[model samples]
Target chain A: MSLISLALYIFEALAGAAALGILLVRNVFHAALLLIVCLISLAGVFVIYNAEFIAVTQILVYAGGVLVLIVFGIMLSSRIAGKPLVVTNQYVLPASLAGILSAGILIKLFSEQPFAQQPGALPGNPMNQTGIALMRDYVLPFEIAGILLLIALIGAAVTASSFYSKKQ
Target chain B: MEHTLILSSILFAAGLMTVIVKRNAIMVLIGIELMLNAANLNLVFFNRNNPALSGHFFALFVIVVAVCEAAVGLAIVLRVYKYYQTSIPDQLTELKD
Candidate 1:
């Protein structure tokens, strides 16, 4: 295998392992940390796929932003409960069986599908093209995404506020 | 490309197991995040050769939606914990008392 393919395999292994660890680990905080590992490894995979922008966004948004939010949730909830945030499995056997079976089916289906044999030529300036597409063709959806984010921000704030405490 | 697809399928399976096996709400949310990332990876992989940038744009939007989902979902979990004093979904059975 070439250096690039080797790197791709290595990153894929890391991401898959971290994802499995996230599921098997019981502690909420530890799971969050493992998720960071998984997400970073995925960023590497994106880099291999020639998606440098998506890779950077993955690191910035997922590892930096969302994981922090989850960690905060773990800390805050545990703090109030006065206990370390330990999680437990409920339906391990059934869940594992289902997961494995579904995965096998998906893999079989994916491999059977026809795909373009020759990989298309890479864009000369991917970043510039991406910016242009967002500004021109997909501008409407882009604006909608912004509005969706804004609404989610207000909704989260409203939902998380302690209305019961205020009433008391 | 096939390898990447297989890898994503594995990740999706792991996420599914996490969602079903874990009792904690936060962990469930993490599972959902994993699943979303798997789908995003597939989109990027498929769009690697396409010049329209549709796959990349879709992946970007997926990320945006994921952020909103995590934020709002975590907020709901926090509120549920405060009200019920537990983070396990199986415990929160009642809607209105």
Candidate 2:
């Protein structure tokens, strides 16, 4: 096998293992940390696929932004409860069966399909191309995403704030 | 190509299991994030050869949506925790009390 393929394999294995660890870990904090490992390894996988921009965004948005939000959620809720958040599993047999069955079906379908694997390389820097595409062809959607983000920010703030709490 | 697909499917399955099994609402949100990441991985991998960079742009938009989802979801979870004094979904059943 080529070096790139070898690296891909290693990253894939790490990501899969970390994802499994997230599933098996009982502590919410530890699970979030394991999810960081899984996400970073997947970012490496994105790099192997020549999606450097997505890899960086994966690290920035996912590992940096979303994870911090999740950790904050954990801490806030736990403080209210006056205890560490301990995740519990329910319907283990059914959930595992569902997971394995879905995985098997998807793998079988993907393996059966014939994909023309083109090792086509982008001409310019991917980030540059992405910027141009966003500006030119995808400006509408980009603006919509901006609006959506604004609404979400306001909504989160309003929802989380103690504006209408009952007198306790 | 196929390897990436399989990996994404596995990730999706794991996320599904997590959503089903975990009692904590935040953990369920984490699982949803995993599933979204799996979809993003598939998008980037499939469109790697395309010149239009559609998948990359789509993944960017997906990340935006994910951020929004995480923020709003966490806020709702916190609100629920504050009012109910519990974050477990099963423990909260009344729509309005």
Candidate 3:
């Protein structure tokens, strides 16, 4: 295969492995670390696909922000560290069966979908145009996302601080 | 080509299973994050071939939303832990039978 395809394969394998590791690992901190690895590898896949903007954002938002927050949350919420979180036996078998069936269906669909070959070197310089569109055509959704973010921040602060309230 | 999509789907399925089967709140959050990443992977793959940058933009927005969701969800989980002394979903079933 071509060099680009080879690189893509390697990155995809790494990403998939990391994601699976996150699922299997019981330690919450280690799981979060595996998730960071998965996210970074996925960002690499984005770069291979010429989605540089998304690649950077994946690293910035996921690896840098969300994963850190998750790790902190695990630390703050759990009294025990490096231990397996409590697991329930109620739905494990059914959930596994359903997961396998859905995965099979998705794999079938993916195989059937006719994906065109990368046609004539995809436009490598769309970042500027994409930015313009975000600010112009998609201004409303963009602003709405900002407002949502603000509300989330306020909500988190309020919820967290409420824990420290003195009882009257 | 097709393999990438298959892998993404597997990731999504595994994440869904984690969310459904795992009792820990943090594990559930991790599963949700994994599912979101799977969707982002699909968006990036489509953006590779499509001329329009819509998929890429949507992926960007998804990333932002995922971050906000994680922050807020974790904050709630922390509050729950403080009040209930546990983050296990089955144990926090005050509303269930």
Candidate 4:
């Protein structure tokens, strides 16, 4: 295997393990941390695939942004209160069965699809190409994405404000 | 690409397991995030060329949506916790009636 493939394997393993940790870990805080680990390793996986923009965005948006939101969620609610968040064991059998069934389906579908094992290297800097594409061909969607983000921000502020106003 | 797919699927399964098993509302949201991330990984791995219009753009958009989802979801969770004083799924069954 090449060095890049080796890196892919290691990072993928890290992400996979951290994903499992998120599932099984009892503490919500710890689970959130595990999720950060999983996300960061997946960013590494993105890097292995030569998706540097996505890798950086994964780290910035996921690890930096979303994780803080989750951790804040954890802290805001005193109900959970450092308690073990493990689920009831009754779900074990069904969860495992569903997991395996989906895995089988996923593997079957992917096997049918034709993905290139080794993609040709791009001629230009990916970031530059992405910027140009966003500005030219994908401009509408880019603007829509920005608008969606604005709507979400306003909606979140509105939704959360009810409690904030009541507290004052 | 195959290895990445396999790993992504495993991660998806783990996320599904968590969503199925966890009663905590926040934990379920975390599981949902995992599933979304797994999907994003698949998109990035299979992308051959055209980083801008390809999976990269979609992935970027998805990340934005994820941020929105997390913020709104957490806000709603906190609202529920404020009134109900519980974050467990089973106990918050007001809609069941």
Candidate 5:
């Protein structure tokens, strides 16, 4: 009913559709592109919730960082430029059934849960507050996340380099 | 809030289907990304409702973790593709004896 929820709905639709595109498209390149769309729309969804900081991070980390990494992996691992990457659909029956059952359970749980509290007013943006908290109270975890990311970078480099070493 | 939850549920389901049906290693990673995004959506949605800032903070951490996961996962995928000459997960059965 409200304009924000309307925007929310639109972004959600865009994201969901793009997610489906990631699955349905046979070309890994197209699927990677679809993933960028999905990730961007999800960033929009984060914006709709007034979490501007998270939204920007979503774009920065996901669209800018992760999706590019995926594309790089696709390019380096094989030549998918001309060929469409199709796969056999032998596992669809079980997975689809699992997907369906989980969806049903989630929908039923959502219907039954009573939402009594009115949604809060949208704050301007929590960027300042979140920054302060991250530096002050959450500084330890913040530092640890940096550590984790650094470790991941080194580990990934080592793993990928092992392949090249084997080749040489 | 409920609408957001339901939308995220659909996203998660789609991710599940992607993981299940797609045999391409990259596709499975994409599905995993979708699922992670769905959880992040819910966390942000609830943070909107309550303003505790916990959800917002955790969402950021989740993003960080996702970045790490993608890097490591892609490296592993690339390594496997190099050795196996294919990205199809079902076909890689050398160690399954």
Candidate 6:
């Protein structure tokens, strides 16, 4: 196998392992850390795909910013720091069966599709072009998304303060 | 050649299992993050060959949106935990009449 394919395989393995780790880990903090690893591995996959911008943003936003926020949320909400939450038998069978069916369908669909291997052409580095498109073609939605994030931030701050005050 | 798809499927399956088996609200959020990342991985893999740059661009947006979702979702979880003193989904039945 070529080096590129080898790297892809390695990154894919890391991503899969990290995802499983996140699921299996009982501690909330450990699960958050595993999620950071999973996001970083995903960033590596993006790099292998030649999406440098996305790779950097993935590391920056998801691994760094968002994961930290999640961990902080876990820490601040409750005093139960080390105990593992109990898993109930509410929807286990149905969810497991659905997961299995979805996995099978995805595998079958991907296997059947003839992935045309057109000599991997390095498409004219369109990172700059993408920025232009975001600013010009998709400007409205972009601005709207920004507004939504601002509203979410405000709402979170308000809710957090009220919740904390209520506890004391 | 076929490894990428196989790996993506595994990650997706793990995420599904997480959502199914874990009863903690935080665990559920982690599951959602895993599922979103699995989709992002597929987008990057497919964009490796396509020249249009659309898939890569969408992947970028998906990452951003995932971050925002985590932020908002975690904040809500924090509020719920304060109100109920627990993050377990089974214990959170205040509105379930």
Counted clashes in each candidate structure? 0, 0, 0, 0, 0, 0
Report the C-alpha lDDT of model 2 over A20-132, residue by residue, as the tens digit: 88889999999899899999999998887778888998999899999999999999899988889998899899999999999999999888888868545778787788888
User: Which residue runs does candidate 6 get wrong by more than 4 Å?
Assistant: A78-91, A118-121, A163-168
When summed lDDT is taken over every stretch of 10 residues in candidate 4 chain A, the lowest stretch is A81-90
Docking quality category of candidate 4 according to DockQ thresholds: medium
Single-chain TM-score of chain A, each candidate? 0.92, 0.92, 0.88, 0.86, 0.87, 0.84
Per residue, candidate 4 scores C-alpha lDDT tens digits across A55-124 of 9999988899889988887876744454544444347789989988997799888878887667456677
DockQ of each: 0.78, 0.80, 0.67, 0.64, 0.70, 0.61
TM-score, each model?
0.95, 0.95, 0.91, 0.90, 0.91, 0.88
- Comparing 2 with 6 on DockQ, the higher-scoring candidate is 2
Q: Which prediction has the highest lDDT against the true structure? A: 1
Alpha-carbon local distance difference test for all models = 0.91, 0.89, 0.82, 0.83, 0.84, 0.76
User: In model 1, what are the clashing residue pairs, if there are any?
Assistant: none
> Which of the two, 1 or 3, has more DockQ?
1
Query: Each candidate: fraction of true contacts kept?
Result: 0.87, 0.83, 0.75, 0.68, 0.81, 0.64
Candidate 4 regions with alpha-carbon error over 4 angstroms: A79-90, A112-116, A162-168, B50-52, B95-97
Using DockQ as the measure, the top candidate is 2
Residue A94 in model 3: lDDT: 86
User: Which ten contiguous residues of candidate 6 chain B have the minimum total lDDT?
Assistant: B88-97
TM-score of 4: 0.90
Q: In CAPRI terms, where does candidate 2 land? A: medium
Tens digits of lDDT, candidate 6, A1-168: 798767877877888888877766767778888888878877877777778778988888887888888878777754544544444434777877877888888888899987766326455765776677778877887787778778877876776667557575
Say which prediction, candidate 4 or candidate 6, comes out ahead on DockQ.
4
**lDDT, residue A96, model 3:** 83
Docking class of 6: medium
Residues B13-92, candidate 5: write the lDDT tens digits.
98999888987888889899999998998898777765558898999999999999999999989878877778888888
